[model samples]
Target: MKMICMAVMLFITLLSAGAQKNIPASDIKTAMMKATRFMVEKVSNRGGYLWNYSPDFSRCWGELEAKPSMIWIEAGTPAMGNVFLNAYQLTGESYYLKAAQAAADALIWGQHPSGGWPYMLDFSGEISLKQWYSKVQKGYIHCAQEHAHYYGNCTYDDAATYDSGMFLLRMYLLTLDPKYKYPVERCLDFVLESQYPIGGWPQRYPLRYEYVKGDKEDYTSFITINDGVHTNNINFLLACYTLLGETRALEPLQRAMTCVLALQGGKPQAGWAMQHKLDLNYSPGHARDFEPAGYAATATAEMCRNLMRFYRWTGDTKYLARIPDAFEFLESIRYSDAQMKQLGKSVKPGQILCPTFVEVGTNRPLYLHNDPDHYWVDYDYHGLITHYSSTRAIDLQSLKDEYQHLLSLSKEEATKDSPFIGQTDISGTLLSHLMRGKVQQADTQKVDSLLTILKKKDYLPGRLPSVSKENPGFSDAPLPSEVISIKEYMNGMSTFIQYLTK
Candidate 1:
């Protein structure tokens, strides 16, 4: 009986050791390099990357217009820059520095004339041409008629004013160039001026007093009605505060943070809700609900990190205490073992849900909706995975096991040869898995081969491929590739890799 027990224990120990040996650090590095390289080559342009490089430039262009965006240049540029930054940090390579600088330059140039940035940029010159066509035969008929005058001279505006400023501030912290400093200051000024009397920043600014003939009247003011004072604004403010600490901007940062906390929804229990106004002292209205939208998790996590940095600089726990609840809120929304299991069952093998849940509330099941009909509806999980990997909030063993399960599921799905289980799901999940330290040499090699194929095919240089309507389950309408929004993912991945290296 004693010998039997001893034998079982020995076998268990061997299995554990075998599992440990199977995880190759090299594989993780290789896969990360592949994905990062793909992101850099494809998403990057001038100094910033286009929001997405899929299906074609037209598709990428369309996705940028489909939403009220602000963070594309700020997020995507810096994200690409950070990838280079990480490479430089790891290898001390001048090439990486050059790449980083290019991205920084794009970001700097992408800043709006108003000292803020748009959520998108018409880098391709298409939007400007469209605008020009609409104005032809109107007030500027001769001006519009002169193709020689506007051919290469047509300039585009930044997509979102606020996001541009915020991204510039972040870039300033990294580069510390005097050139960046002025823009940051200007952006700060613009944000202050644009702040609503009620507290939140308006969705767009100067109210576009009058529209150009043939131009669509800016309806951002009306759209702002539904947006509320959001967590995203709070995050940008916090980022500005962190980057420009103890400056004139400090007081406004404090005010914004205080206002955000005041807007915390109580019935949903403790997490923040979008406030209708900026008053820190006012009671939140019934219109607000605690949904995970508005980049809540990312904002909350960033706020926590920024607050901790603030505490370090200022020696205050007040900022530090705000983190636990925010962290708890983020954790509540992440996929648990049970949740992942259910998601796996629903997704045909290779696919995994990008954003694990639609909202912060519990009592929801994992399911795919046909309307949006991309493989996954949400891309927010990239942020969550990044936060988890960086903080080590969850058990490493648990995370590794879950990643292995995901890898198995991906492999299973790939074998079925379903077109739906394509690069989006495979790349996203595998990259997330590698970030969490579950390294598989075979999987990594496969990803590397796939990336090589993509590059050789010239598919890597343009926007992400859109799903074809011909596919049985595919949606006819365009599905935005989360990869197009490269900034957040780039930063998150860079941070995760840096954390792991440390």
Candidate 2:
């Protein structure tokens, strides 16, 4: 959340060009120094960051919420708090720790008593404290469910609060500060309290549902996968249960995991809906219009990976066994080359535009209306579309390799147990290698190389948005070249930051 980065051409080039290129530690150290300097000089603001920015000496321009701005860092960016901690660990830099502490302080200020934080926190007035008030008294802020004017209420839809709480957990681990630990514990409470009695989490909580006539609609309170509500929260619970040794965390984790497993569509079907209805009987359902209720190819892939993560965490074959069918669901709906040629779309090498959604039972790919506000989606017929958001493509040719690897795991082959044992880990494996103290010069060099490439990409000019109208608290947009991406890291630079700093 600190910075927006995209998939860089250099990364893909390197990947396809060489398989097992090693990077040196010194190179990584130097790149880290430069990257941190850039972050502190250009990105950091009172310990917070604009989603994306382009700096020139003392002046800079920012873009957030798809709008250009002269400067703004009012919301988001707490994830950087932990990223800095990781940086401090790698570099032994007090500067990084200090930066992290400042970010932590910002998160503390933004946090709600429920341990959730809003997507954006504007502190210009008394709005911060007002956000916590639930009364109908004058000057008291209303819940977003009650009034749209309220902006600082706890949110998890875009990882608003859960992510910040996770940062607090890291800070607590680093400093042993009660301030940090307290919020983390309350955040855990929020997770437990927020979970639907049936187990899944809503996009937002306190389960605010709309009272329409005599009926109730869950609204944002539905079990959500839009921004990884349940998965991210389950991940936090897993961390608490594992790292903090909080036995109480176990039940919720298990329940959430069970809910996820159950959520996977069974027999004659597979995969998960991006969001689901509150009713557990219908495990896959809808949230918004654009997000038609169906099997989301993207979320299914993430769910498969997450299952693998749980398997690795607990050595539970149940999670491992969950992998293939999801993959099966994925492969079933993949667009055939014939289909692509039929559509008259030029395909990227090693990539295909996979269906973003597949109609349940029917197993047909869905294409929705272009409008984000509302959409009439149809899976019964095809449509001409290329936008990444509507129908995001994936380099599944690479995934086929992983698919085969996971499939091989089914067999008790000795090599499959430790395939990388005698072979090179060209797949950018990091955690285990780092833990075993087998981190080589090449490992750091790879990160350094990536950071160097990203540093350059961060400065590129293309597809710059020029808003048609001026926004409150911001100036007229700069030239498209002067403007910069706030959400650039949405691509894959986030992985570089995580990998290099770790």
Candidate 3:
């Protein structure tokens, strides 16, 4: 029976390879380049990009309605720029490199003097950007805490600064240009300086603690692990140490890793939270009202992966010690079928189900509801908000499998696979590997479909329900008219790049 399964898998692999061979490489390259050119030339605002834009290019946005001079850093500009770099690696085209350079230039222009970047960069300057923040804070009813006041500080939230710094590093490596090096150095210094004495980083840097929600002070200054803050920062510094031989990043990186270990809750809970108090305790009610202080299922799951990554990076057995308890805690708190139905969630097969927010001390699942005027959280699951999910899909089984796999590896075998293995500088293959880290196999059928669509539209289609003055914010709702998405274009381009490389 095992032989039969093996034979089936081998046949499937051959079939996939054969199918790929049938597709002309030149055709794929042509489509990829055309799509790339359209985005780089027509859609971009000053060589930078937003999340999405209208098909006609009449409307565009990045978490908010952006001005002509503005570009988003989080998954907008840097993401597109990375794709351009990937394209250059595959084809060795100066065009792709030049496009990437333009993106790097834009990011450099947006770089705050403090050595990091904000969520969005506006060419119009600081005063205009602060005024825009005030407008958003006054108009938006939800997420009041996030926009309460503009602090003119670089945010670690959503990986705005970290990702930009990475792009700059990549550019510097490729061009051997000082233009990219100085900013990336400053960016690294900012990270090292902004870290808490105990090691965790705040949601926003240069800690103001001014953002007020009701009577409570801002959560931005807390030691944050939300959005993989520790993980991203650690990886960035590790890359600096590995690729550039920057010694300053090494000690700070160790401190940050130690902070992750310190932040874990005690035995019975044995999980992690989105943010922690400076004293290293669980912090809840962060950025929004519905986020109650407790063990966040998503954050805990990510923490488990972070531990695994740390183990891989350093061969530290201690990192693996807490993972089992974390897994057990996750399994213990899963929502039963009755609870899921009450919460209007259906558990698909093989889906690891749990609530997004778990209450502290008692370990009860917290459900969030959107009232007419405000968002609130409680035990009741009924009438949960549609905007944000009350339940999260965390594959604890995958985490367990990864942990087991790591344990099975000999130390030599594990160390050989580390990114630091015998590498002094970034090679094309290594950089490409980093770019495509842990991503699932790209679907050839989807690539073919996207390429066909791109030919007609000259861009990838995105979901945009409506774009009007009344509803200026973006939405994921399906609409009749196709919209252009930076993310989709990147994904499509990446798929082609991956196939071409193979």
The most accurate candidate by lDDT is: 3
Higher-scoring candidate on lDDT, 1 or 2: 2
Runs in model 3 deviating more than 4 A are: 1-21, 143-148, 280-285, 346-351, 409-430, 437-444, 465-480
Tens-place lDDT per residue, model 1, 1-502, is 9999999999999998767544344554554565566555654555556555344433333222222122245235554565666666676646667777776566667655666655444454546644533433232211112211222211112223444454455445556877767876877776666655444454455444232223223222321322322434444554555435525555665565454444443433344422232335333221111121232333344344444434433333465554556555555555655756643423333322223222434413222221221122233323222111111122323323433443354344423422122333343332232123222233433444544544444333323333211122112456434334453344334433553464
Can you write out model 2's per-residue Cα lDDT over 317-404, one digit (the tens) per residue? 6876756677677677777878766655555787666677878788877776544232467753354332334555665666666656
What is the Cα-based TM-score of model 1?
0.47
- What TM-score against the true fold does each predicted structure earn? 0.47, 0.68, 0.88
**lDDT per residue, candidate 3, 288-348, as tens digits?**
6777778888988998998887777677788888889898888888878886776666766
Candidate 3 — worst ten consecutive residues by lDDT sum? 465-474
Report the Cα lDDT for candidate 1.
0.42
Predicted structure 2, TM vs. truth: 0.68
Each candidate: RMSD: 15.5, 10.4, 5.5
The 10 consecutive residues of candidate 2 with the worst lDDT sum are: 135-144
Clash count of each predicted structure: 24, 12, 1
